[model samples]
Target: MKKIFGIVVVSLFFLSSQVNAQHKIRIACIGNSITYGATLPNPEKDSYPGQLQNMLGDGYEVMNFGVSGKTVIRNGDNSYVSTKKYEEALQSNPDIVTIKLGTNDSRLPYRLKLDSNFIDDYKALIHSFQQLPSKPKVILLLPVSSFLKDSERQTDEVIVNQVIPKIRQVAYEEKLEMIDLHSITADKESLFPDKLHPSVLGETILAKRIYESVVSKKKMDFDIFSKIKEEKKNSSFYGYDCVDFIFKGRNCKVVKPRFSASGLPWVWRARFFGIEPQADIALLDRGFHLVYCDVAELFGNQEAIDCWNAFYEKMHGAGLSKKVCLEGFSRGGIYVYRWAVTNPKKVACIYADAPVLDLKSWPGGKGKSKGSQEVWEIFKKDFGLSSEEAAMDFKGNPIDLVPQIVKAGFPMLHVVGDADDVVPVDENTKIFEERVKALGGNIMVIHKQDVKHHPHSLKNPQPIVDFILHSVKF
Candidate 1:
């Protein structure tokens, strides 16, 4: 019996050693509400520990070191909650330790003013992880928005003014990886539950921010499906929501944003970055925004035309004189060509990729079936004209608009794929580009191989942005 017991103990020890050898990587996540997911029940991974562990892959075992109601400064009353948990987790000799805290330390409730001493304490906390036995890569987790200071009920002004710049500065100086969770969580009310704590999506975004930042720093291809662009290095491509700072040129005008009966659809604008937002100030000052419109609202024909009309009216009122460069997908192409024929002087360029330009060209179009009869109804109501007259008025036919485009000498750039069965390239972009060139206009067409009508920003995300950036003329 004694001999059998000894053999069993040896077997158990060997098995444990084998398991440890199989999983060599260790990661730890430490922080307060956002990290522990306060409003949320703790899952095996509700914290960033689970998020990062899953991101690293099957080999990693990340420990959750986050604690709710924690602050960086303990105030000698022993109120600081995170330190104890962090110390315990470090015993495993982690390969990476992430510290996500300090917003609570900076906010008014705890009233913990962050002076030099506080910064020193943060430095020490960072140093402790740096000096760990494994000496893991340390990343500083920046905080997003604090609770809105009431009265605004909107967090746009709050985050843009107070939090983001400081966080950016910290990352720049410390040479630590900055996970810009604030970028996605800007409209805190949207991402948050009570407008104080984050929702499930927000927590997921927080995890995503850390995961991408760490992975991208290694300069490896980000394996995540949705690869959102993040601000990198000292090169400042701003996420500042101070929209007033964006000047619309001509008479040195600044658009003092006023909400119409429509409370300025700030949520939608923030959510959909249709294309890249980076722009040179000099180009904007010379009149670049006039040609672009957010076609997110358009799918139906009449609705699309109305949206274009509204955009044009606004540009005219703004005294925008510089020629505009136009780019959009599907129904947006319909609106752009329709307006360009009439207002030729205003159009600098146009590029419609996988465009829904002609009604008859589409499947189940109003020409064949009553598929778009609802759209036809709205068209009659809006322009008080018959179907044929309104289609001619809007010139839904880009081919018809060609004579006017030729006379105007507008430059255009297009990207489309032959594999796009929805909007066949030959019928749309191929024919249109040929017409523009025939009309003595310089048009650049990039035929994407085996792809569909995707935003140039969506595919390898830089060239189309560069084209737009350079396409503008003063």
Candidate 2:
């Protein structure tokens, strides 16, 4: 009887251990050299996956299935699907999988086949993970920026212009969550010692980002409308509840939707608030919040940018989406474009109606339009332009910022009155469209045959609404 009791106790203990192990959430880190911690001193302990495990604590099991010089493209030089790590990752039976491949696929030899095989192979890989009995939640990661100056091997331009877009397309089509790792390391050259792989500090940043994305669960009890009501003055905006408040000494307003959207997507209106608000009304109907901050007469100056910067932080903290669709009308164009250029990653898309692209064209009266001398003087003073020549030489116009704006990779749409003497299409939208198209930037221009600047937005508003919805992936 004593021997029988001892056997039963040991068996019970073994079953308890198995149950505890199964309770921990398993995460499989799948990627190329960067995920493998190629250059790090101690990959096992200091790698991003290792660091992620530590950050996730005992409640999670993080497995690093990264292989060096691996490509997600099946026909690429070294296909990730063919690797032993891929098989092991499948065997891990993870609850979540993070795929961060693409760096090696950007190489010249492999890049040639990317157009044909990338999307198909990527889908196949995701399908493989989805077929697993675990049915893991797969997260796509945009590869980190490669600071390598070489044009052939992992160039930033190719990654940004080519590879990243493909990945975004796949994510959108697959309806998968994507973490923009490319933007995290962009312009942070010091963090990448060899220009190819991230240093230990950089790995820490990546790990923290992944942890925030996968491990941290946002509190569902917090309601944005409740918070707004508690803190701000309430009003009505086109039949919707509008909350008014002061942020950074600027008058701000947020129009609440009857039902909040899945992502809490929002449109940030610059300058104009309620004039010809068809698009705003439509967006509100589709469960989008309409937000505005009074930066009028600021002319998209440094002060305006600073005000917007603070306003953005407050809204993001209030649980709004990380990116916003920008709407600019007439002079409001300056405000939206200026802010978008500075905070490119923060913007999802831009819709400008009769926008003032070049200050010299409208306010400065340097172009065909009969300009506003009063506003021009204010603009010059705001920009610190000592004379007319200085204003002429000013390169801060949206037209001048086309390259940076294009590189930011956000789509733009312009609605212009072909016959308007004020903020003429020829000087503003036409020039902007031409320049944007030249650089392979995405821009759509809608010319209202005989309309003027007085009428802003479309009568139907369907096209504008569709553009915003598509850009934000709603």
- Indicate which candidate wins on TM-score: 2
Residue 446 of model 1: what lDDT? 73
In model 1, the clashing pairs are: none
Per-residue alpha-carbon lDDT of model 2 for 354-390, expressed as tens digits? 9999999998887788899999999988888899999
Model 1 clash number? 0
Candidate 2 to truth, TM:
0.54
**Please, what is the TM-score per model?**
0.45, 0.54
- Candidate 1: misplaced stretches above 4 Å? 1-23, 55-57, 74-82, 109-112, 150-164, 214-474
Tell me the spans in candidate 2 whose CA falls farther than 4 Å from its real position: 1-12, 218-474
State the displacement of the C-alpha of residue 178, model 2, in Å, after optimal TM-score superposition. Answer: 0.3
- lDDT for 20 (candidate 2): 89
Output the worst ten-in-a-row residue range by lDDT, candidate 2. Answer: 215-224
Worst 10 residues of 1 by lDDT: 258-267
